[model samples]
Target: MGGDLSQTEVLVIGAGLSGAIACQRLARAGIGVTCLEQGEWNPRESYPGDKPDFELQALGPWNANPNIRRGKADYPILDDTSDIKPLLFNGVGGSTVMFSAHWMRFLPSDFFTYTLDGVGTDWPIDYHELEPYYLQTEADIGVSGLAGDPAYPDRPEYPMPPLPIQPWGEKVAEAHDRLGWHWWPGSNAINSRLHQGRRPCVQRSTCRAGCNEGAKGQADQSIWPSAIAAGAKLVTGARVARILTNPQGRAEGALFVDEFGVTRKACADIVVLAAHAIGTARLLLKSVDAAWPDGLANSSGVVGKNLMMHPMNRMVGFFDEPMSSWQGHWGQSIYSMEFAETRAEHDFARGAKWNLSPTGGPLNAALYPLDDPQPFGVDLHDRVDKWLGRSALWGMVAEDLPDSHNFLTLDSAHSDVDGDGLPRLHYETSENSKRMLSFMAKRARESFGAAGAYEVAEQTLAAEIGWHPLGTCRMGNDPRNSVVDKWNRCHDIPNLLIVDGSSFVTSSCVNPAATISAIAARAVDRLIHCRSEY
Candidate 1:
């Protein structure tokens, strides 16, 4: 059977936020770029606000839909291993499709955690190096927040205004103020005002179900469109099986399977692995050949070693007043950075933020209360309905240290639906991580108490799951302890760049996407400058 093989100046695997930004930057530099996504190109109109569809996308089956799940299907986790669940997205925009749009850059101290606090690994590049790029990315994605916030870096003003504070936000802020905690409007990727061609957020609450209003700036609605408009080619439903390397051990292209399961080859002068942390590391580990038997860029055996995920726990509170928590952007509202800074003398874990998350609809709310095995009846329904609007839910996203034990390995028994062995996550929170989470949970409890919550209930740590997984393929100055260099180019394979959460050396206390995008932009600039040498 005949098949198609194509070539471009640069080939980006995964069409998620990082891949989309990389493609956009590369294409704007006059480079020929092609982005291959495992999921279809789902437009904004396809996302509907329905409980069943939302639950399906958040749970299974439809969860792999790029329009819904993003690139979650590429890396399935065995959440049943422990009580804690692991969430991943499968699709073009990846997890950004369903992410909370919490666009936060790590504090300057986050980069020097090990050096300053004597814990974890220090980032090869510091916040100063990434500050400019962070500003650029924030502007590019239309982040909304005020500058001069003590919790964040002193940066330029956000492109758009902050999302309107909700009743829950006001309450949280009041609690923080009373407790002497630092609180601010979270830097969100959702548009608060009109920017570019996108419309302002209409205060529609179901952002996880996919924003039909085109306000939340997922890659599909933001960078991917700009990249495609700038002459970049996006091929969806294409799964990259492995990276193709020359005899010199330099990456040349990739072997991919199309939607029809037809094997094809695409040669490129440069290959970028933006397939998230686990997927990128797995691809490198799977690309063994004559020159490198272990993996493509596994000379240091650190491709998947320093796997880190932000373990999160939620604190639910019921109030007598009507807050209507589910009335606006899912990620919109307030953030508390009171505990984000590390204190070596305090013997405390890293600080966590308490952000106001959307109050779930009927089905999602059911999952929470039903954890107690309560009988389903009118009492349950009445309780759920009464608490639904008045409840204020806050999530504690604490940092997890990178450990060899918390890693991703190929599951020998599990395979994709097509029988290809999918990468299995062999992750467990370290003792230190659990301790940190416990510390953060205690703080969350205090915050809830201060908020005058009538009944504050903290979920058990066993129910905590990591949504932001980072540092699977970290970048460093030396290849001995890292997968890629400071410029994000693989040490063994100079032409191969891994730009994503995978390149993070340390899991910061904040969300990773803003940092990832800034790093990708910086890498693209470096790649462009070194194009002639290549």
Candidate 2:
């Protein structure tokens, strides 16, 4: 399985959400495709939610941080210089295994941020161009929610009904209504009713720990199976070393180390790198040779620049009455996007969406105090129990403006077992982001107060890792300013395509999985239409 390889029409580097969707679309177009995954296959029942030792896994490798959740497939990322550490999974489904399953789409204005708000680079493609693909991706994943929200553009109805609102969501809704702010049940990837042979969500509320019910839209549970059934092949435990190129400066395929530690080459007519933002940038930066000394497809010298992540802040509200905040379901019940865009009165260029996660699990409850002051022995138990059933956590996702200073570069000092350079993230909050966080924090406290919170705790401007990392390898109309073109094809290396979060131009103030899938869908369509170019 290591040494020699068969060349296929398409080779996808990761079996994550983008890769799976790309494989399915390519296969449907009568093209042969194969996926190489660094992690092993994870079955639905393989998730450790029901085990007695599951609670401890959160403190261990199952935590969001790769340094903390060091599994066999995980690679090290250096972040000593960065404020926010990145959290990711290397398996077939990628980070969706630990994601909150929030499936919000980017608004039309998000794509035109540079033109509309005078900040960030504008996306070469617009929302109307990707709206069809977004709808297709939503239907394929079986998203649950009500459409026709006044804040968003006109869109198709969701595949399934919205999840039942919890006590926390109801309180948030009431507060928003009183304040004349807009609120709606968030679009979730978790199923409320059985769809496409999968079971409905049972309200276990442990989605980030991995879903045991196969109801959450992890790529492994959704499109990966469809791609496999369509004759696309997948090879697990294969860590890609670099993109292999020819004298013509076109991508031929990738060189990787198999699970047995054997060097292997997977040749393909075209290659798609969907290893998330950080992994994709690291590989591109490391694939340097005499023909292209700087790096493969890095003629613009921006393969890993302009890294962005949403700066998140959480506000907690406590009540005297016991609240049923521990119900096992999709964590965020309601969301407000009234301030998702920019305004003349605001000092920030972009804004954030506030989400109410009513039932934060025990592990999260225990960890919340780490941001605040930790309580002592007997007081710890009392505090944990008090907040466990009586508090609501509001997550504010502020839009992060991309800066060249905030970027990813390979570390000269740190290398993996295969001797490839490790990714070093250099991130800091911009002045615009700082202003946004300050404004949102005050609004959150006000909102919670309006909801009758006896006491409110604000996690202000803290150093927390962002789940959505984007803009490292951005797309644009010109090769000098971007890594990829509007079609997601590498400007320097036309045969190489990046169909993941690495291709995002802006970090829209919502979870990016939906947009990632939409990009993959649109990119594959372009690939099929221009098949002879590769």
Candidate 3:
């Protein structure tokens, strides 16, 4: 690679959800922008299909645990103290390449969690501030869902109608209705019809392996392409090592190792970090300099503190009748947010949200809990017959609060192939999180029983991993306690910004892709509008 300076008005790191959006917004504003990404582009055609061995590929690199994935682009993480494994993709699209694409907005109460629930820190921004950005992101990504969900804020109709509700979805909806719970058609980032010139999903039910069709709302598919076309440069295979600052303590650019293992410097007028929670935190912690011996933006001494992950639990129900589990989208089932907020009667500060699916594909269903022995002969025949098209799985996501013990730091004992210090994540489920999971698991079993399942079984939570990592570089009003300010700019480094999930102060009890994108959009818009102030 040439040692050409990253000649741009703004340089963004990571080409994932937030990074892609930031680039698009900046480039569209006619400001020169460039994106530096560690991983290479994964062509949509390369996504795995529904073969017998197809599910194995997900376990290899798509499972979210870099250690288990062990791909060349993935970096190893030291998570011995964590209850959940970190699941993320390293390439252009980030984790959305394998995400379930359940696009949910954070409830109003989520913004005031600290004030209302007395648990997590309250976000500097709220749902109302992000509502318009949510709408814009939904249209840009072609989200499909119905409006008028009483459980959420009032918003315009979706870009398209909800995906066709299969019989399984209807069954789950009926069960929730019977239980007097609010079940709505899930808000999905997957296209229901041909919108934005992309073809509708073929109902592959293999989203985790990467969406072969352009139906899913991956950053690589939707945002990155537009940004590049609008004059944003995307430099892949550039793994950023540390952020560089000048004598005045403002961000100058970054030092990265190119794909050829050559060290280079890419300077810019402004630098944005959108490498997700762990990646962003790791880079900042590793950049120990003369002015700042701790990190680039560690003046508050909170660079890697307050890490959080949404604890998840799974419940499986085996029915006596066939349900044709293989046909529709795996994550397009009913979504219930009845327990998304905390109640005074409950000991936990926050509750959980759930989505129901048929655990699509024979191979995936065969390896449901991942520890069960493969049956042979008559046992195989019986197990297959019982679960092939007659079962449903409930994936419950419970909110986790930031704890002092749950944090990320650099591991001096381990380093990546590029000689960058590995991330040592010390995270464990909090007592409140455990209680929330237990309560949600009981509710899941009850729902299955009410849905007329003959047998309902709860999977042991040991195999579960934390999802939707957040809050390592949290934003707040207090500069002494937060890494970034309300505008997503580093308090210590005025020219530095963070536009990923790391800036989130609280993790709502839902998939956070939509929220992350909304924040990126809002941050870039604010930056451009207030550039003269800076």
Q: In terms of TM-score, which candidate is strongest?
A: 2
Off by over 4 Å in 1: 50-75, 79-84, 369-371, 416-420, 462-464
* Cα RMSD to the true fold for all candidates: 2.6, 1.3, 1.7
TM-score of 1: 0.94
C-alpha lDDT of all candidate models, in order: 0.77, 0.86, 0.84
Worst 10 residues of 3 by lDDT: 458-467
Per-residue lDDT tens digits of candidate 2, residues 1-534?
A: 546679999999999899999998998788999999999877767777766666677658578788778899998888887877788888988888888889998988999898998898889899889999999999888799998999888887899988987777788789999999989997899999999999999887778778899899988888888888888999999999989999888899999899898989999999999999998998898899997777778888888899987888888888777776766464568889988889999988989988888645565666674356876677678667767878887888888877899999988788877676788999987888888888888888888888888878778655655687898899998999899999999999999999999999999998899999999999999999989976
User: Tens-digit lDDT track for model 3 on 1-534?
Assistant: 688564678999999999999999999999989889999999987787545566787767567677888777788888887777788889999988878889999999999988997878888888999999999999987799999999987899999999876777787789888899888998888999998888788887888778888888888997888888898999899988878898988898988888898988889989999998999998899899688888879888888888988878888788877778766676657788888889998878888888887576666666566335767678767767777888877888888787767899988778766565789888888888789888888888888888888877666454445557899999998989999988899999899999999898988888899999999999999989998644
Per-residue lDDT for 1-534 in model 1, tens only?
Answer: 346556799999988889999999999889999988887776776676544466545554444222223343454555445334555566778778877788888888888888887778888899989988898888777788778788866787889889977877787788889999888987799999887788888876767756777788888887887898898999888888889998877788988888887988888999999998877887887777778777778998887777777777777777788777657778848888887887675465566666776676655666664235653687678668756777777777777767777676656587755454556566676666566767877777777778877777666563445567789898898889898999999988889999999999888878888999999999988999889755
Which candidate do you rate higher for lDDT, 1 or 3? 3
Q: How would you order the candidates by TM-score, starting with the best?
A: 2, 3, 1
Error of 2 at 21 (Å): 0.7
Q: What is the TM-score of each candidate against the true structure?
A: 0.94, 0.98, 0.97
Model 1: number of clashes? 11
Off by over 4 Å in 2: 369-371
